[model samples]
Target: MWSEETPSLNNQQYQLLQELGRGRFGTVFRCLHRASNRLHAAKLIHKRHLTDSTDRRCLQVEPKAMTFLSPHPNILQIIDTFEDADTTTLVLELCQRRTLFDRLSDDGALPEPHAASLAKQLLEALAHCHALGLAHRDIKPDNLLFDDANNLKLSDFGSAEWFGEGVTMSGVVGTPYYVAPEVIMGREYDEKVDVWSSGVIVYTMLSGIPPFYGESVSEIFEAVLRANLRFPTTIFRTVSAPAKDLLRKMICRDPSRRISAQQALSKFIFY
Candidate 1:
């Protein structure tokens, strides 16, 4: 748990190594703790870039979400947070195996069993977050990371929200390819949106292509809103029936009908 009393560390404590990646608000770096000699990822969010309340709020939400979701095997763990006048730095556990997006880029689609294992792990992480009244609004491949042991973990909760039972959130947030239909339509959605995004991930892993695609953002939004779910013979001919069934339940157009993360974990697709 984090508190006002958490000790703040100085920049000298970490030896900056290499750039890890860039995000909406800042850049992440691979750093070495000077005293512990441990590798960690540090997210450096510049205060100057926080031009609006929304940007600042996202910065605030990530650390809080991490504090709530940590200690889970499938969620990224934040070691510490330090704020200076110019930047807010998050010290995080370094995932040596990189992100699922990188894996997909290098390996194309995964075999059914491999995809199933990754999806199951992702569901476990989502289940943990949802159980705590938190919804990870962004559930794309890029946010799914793996440690040196090839254990998958979910990261990046900047867009996450806290909602109780019977609560809903309204906003058009998320990558176009993975956004739920209800979210694209600007309807009040809940944690089910994460399920929908995960479904799209499953489809991509099996077929090596996104379920919906278009040349323009507007066209993609339209496709998300009205696209029929189909597993073409060319792609899904070899996919198991149970997997397809699970995907359908997750990616349903009606958010109310979408499978919950816990229910999804119980599906035979993971068995």
Candidate 2:
């Protein structure tokens, strides 16, 4: 939960540089720390959007989640936070190598080995989050970023939720294409939702498209709920058998059967 009291630090401390990206409640900027002269990414959230409970919860959860789970190689590090009357600024580690979506857009589909390597990194990060009782409801390509060496780092924890070991979470959160079936069905779900999303990512990486397709958001939800789980020979012709087997298990409709992030790490190799 965020406090309404004005923070000691404000936006003036950082020199805003380039506009990095924009989200529902905030815009990220590559900024400079005036005192230390270090580069950082600043996510400035407008206070007005906090009117909605969901928005407010997201505002409260993101920083806390980042602070709790960071310093890991694959999770984005939150450097500092500043708040004012109009906005809340979160200073973060600047990741400039672009995102997985950019890489997929430019290169179409990645080779199996390359995709497996990135998938391993992402799964390792998810394992860390799940072990700490945090579920990153959104696990799409856009949230998967790369650093200078192209190491994968998971970002955007706004839709994330914290739960007890056996307890399940409720809510229809996450991108349609990557959302798990239980989520779309409005059933209580555990962190296994992440593995389903990761499975979709692997499918998209192997072929240049997702397993389920629809003309609209509703239609996509329909397809996701159906959980057809198919592989069109035209696209998946070159994908290895083991890789496809892993996708089948990961993307399985039943959350109980869905492979956990830690299990996926051991099963992810594609030689």
Candidate 3:
């Protein structure tokens, strides 16, 4: 991981513009293609995150999802990908729009049109990945990217898996808050996990809080496993019935009963 003080890869040809932010595994910097002056986001992964067994798994799966989804307008662009002697670097499209996290923290609840727009962009990008037999496994506010126009883009699939006839579970992974109960419990899961996480994300965005929370992590996990969904009426009184209905379908505890992403795209509230 790069600190503002220490950038791992030493390519003097690449000019650093500024630090965008830091994530679990690394720092991202706004950079310029020295020769062309094109702006980009450069994701720098830590040497340990690339070499360690657990972190390596995250590193491996992230690129597959990124490369597969890179072409979509609703997905972060991978201007180029390269690995150094120590770290992995991705030259990416610079995103100017504030993160959904920032928006929710600042505005509390997003407007209906804004929520719908983000949800639509996310679903389309997700549908494209699912069609390619991939499972993002992790979907939350932090994973969504936005441009200067607030146009949505999907990012950070480090927990993704290539799910096909018989896929490998790089290991039980994903942030607990956004992870599906089945995946957390080590039960066999599929792309449906992403749908569940997306449900949580949408709920958070529209309602101004996550569907469930606890003073401690164990309680939070219990709530998720038991499907103890709650509503803070004060926060969601103005949300439409159609929106609530969609949330229920996406977050259904039983994967067998949950609506698929493609089916969700055609649902009533996909506006």
Model 2 ranges with Cα > 4 A deviation? 1-12, 269-271
Q: Where's the lowest-lDDT run of ten residues in candidate 1?
A: 1-10
Better candidate by lDDT, 2 or 3: 2
Question: Candidate 1: lDDT over CA atoms?
Answer: 0.88
lDDT of 2 by residue, 168-202 (tens): 89999999899999998899999999999999999
TM, every model: 0.93, 0.93, 0.90
TM-score result, candidate 2: 0.93
Q: Provide the lowest-lDDT 10-residue window in model 3.
A: 1-10
Give the clashing residue pairs of candidate 2, or none.
Answer: none
Give lDDT tens digits, candidate 3, residues 215-234.
78888788788887766688
- What lDDT score is found at residue 193 in candidate 1? 93
Candidate 3: stretches off by over 4 Å: 1-13, 49-51, 165-170, 268-270
The whole-model lDDT of each prediction reads: 0.88, 0.88, 0.79
- How many pairs in model 1 have backbone atoms within 3 A of each other, for residues 3 or more apart or on separate chains, i.e. clashes? 0
Best by TM-score: 1
